[model samples]
Target: MSLTSAPGPGWLLFSFGMGLVSGSKCPHTCLCQTPEVICTGKQLAAYPPDIPLNTRRLYLDNNRITYLPAMNLGLLSDLVYLDCQNNLIREVMDYTFVGVFKLIYLDLSSNNLTLISPYSFSVLSNLVQLNISNNPHLSSLHKYTFANTSSLRYLDLRNTGLQILDHAAFHHLITLKTLYLSGNPWNCNCSLLDFSIYLIVSHLDQPGEGLTGS
Candidate 1:
């Protein structure tokens, strides 16, 4: 299926490494610079299906795109950096990134995301930096939600609707260094006892308030 429909009329195309000799294979709604394809602010309602598979970096920010169904990006095996922030995406189906295993940097902030199943990111064993903040509807979380974040170092969960957190969520994040949990309505209660203890002893650089006791 086509990733997305063309934006029509106005489009932008840039230069590549060896330079364009004759025809250009770039999409009509994006600017391709070889390894990097910038499709920002194109009013896209879905991902451009015609993107090159050899693309390493992709920018799809500031669009109206919604829904990242299963195997949506399965063809981009070489994709490393993906920026899908500031979109209208609601939920990320299972196996959405099935074949895009080389991804290490992902930005899903400023979207309408609500449900993030434990299996949404189960294949990103090499993910290092993840940003899922600014999503007001994303309230709950599960320990298995980060099943493959063993290589994760930076996690951003700021400005979310989180009210509680499980300690086991951080148990396997051995390499984690920075964790942002501010702007959440943390209910510092008995359920967070173990997590509170972890915050007191862990080497993570997490600075926030969690003593609501409500």
Candidate 2:
């Protein structure tokens, strides 16, 4: 007489195989794992390696990345903190961060970025802290670059090489509490008075006494 064995769960095996494949397909240059959640500046020229789905914090500082990858970042819904400071990023494409709904803190400082596209922070509704300081080449910011980012409380623009600030630069930043604008060669002319007044009335910072040309 011959005996037959019981059948196993095919769906579970299929899912496990798929997960392994996904993990294998992740970029080889960077460390990608669900159990370990950390990725620092790895000299990545293209998009970052596929991160584990459960990753909560990411450290991507000091890279040469110029743009965000084409992959859908919305899948990393659990990401609550991110650091992309000190990169060569120049421009942030529209909808670059469409799916990062849980991000509460972000650092984009020390990059080669020149201008922030209008509505750049529109999708970052939960961002409470942001840093864009140390970008010496950044000359201008779009009028609505920070529009709809009501949760942002801290903004740092120290040493950004800023010469002029438009009238509506900080228009909708109602929740801003601490702003740093030192180390810049601010014109301190009539055009900057509007920004100076706004900073004073908002209790962000005090102007340095009289105007330079006065």
Candidate 3:
């Protein structure tokens, strides 16, 4: 005689309100809006597990995701905008964003990345806009890779096949304001002479035009 134990207390409040309306719905192919969760180009290879855990903006663009293991987004720890553009990501292992530490706009453009493990932006220290531009087998860029992003402000390595770029690689980007090393192929020599004298003594913006030198 166990029909929920004799009609219990109103059937236990209608089965606890149907488990809170099935845990706040919206996830099967996503498109929620209570904190955004756009699931772009759903050709996703993974990661779409009933999102909506109070998601704070997440757009898995052009899916087919390849890899990003370490904690693998940990659980979108209150993420703040992330667009994995044209996926098929090759590598980015280290902590893999340690759970979006309140990420502020990041777009791994046209993936297939070569490598970027070391401190990978050191927990994104509240990162402010970054796009690993058109990664076509990204050549090299390991000088402490943005040195902890000190609140970075926009940086998009234009073409991404940068041959050599180690002049302290923007030494800690102390609030860097826009830096997009144009379509790379730059092998200027002398290790690019202190990054061309720190871009003419911090004049900054110069790395646009199709800079090719091999």
Return the clash pairs for model 2, or none.
none
Give all candidate RMSDs, comma-separated: 8.4, 11.7, 16.3
Q: lDDT tens digits, residues 91-148, model 3?
A: 8755566656788888998999999865676777788889999996889977877777
Better of 2 and 3 by lDDT: 3
For model 2, how does the per-residue alpha-carbon lDDT over 1-84 read when each residue is reduced to its tens digit? 001111125533553454455633455565656534445667866557556656667677877877764243444656778788
Q: Candidate 1 residues 1-214, lDDT tens each?
A: 1113322122212212212332235668999998998999999998775677678998999999897643336556688999999999998755577667899999999999898877677778899999999998898887878866799999999877888888888888899988888887777778878988897899788766433424
Better of 2 and 3 by TM-score: 2
RMSD of 1: 8.4
Q: Which pairs clash in model 1?
A: none
Candidates' C-alpha lDDT: 0.77, 0.68, 0.73
**Model 1 misplaced regions, further than 4 Å:** 1-25, 207-214
Model 2, TM vs. native: 0.78
- TM-score comparison, 1 vs 3, better candidate: 1
Error of 1 at 92 (Å): 1.6
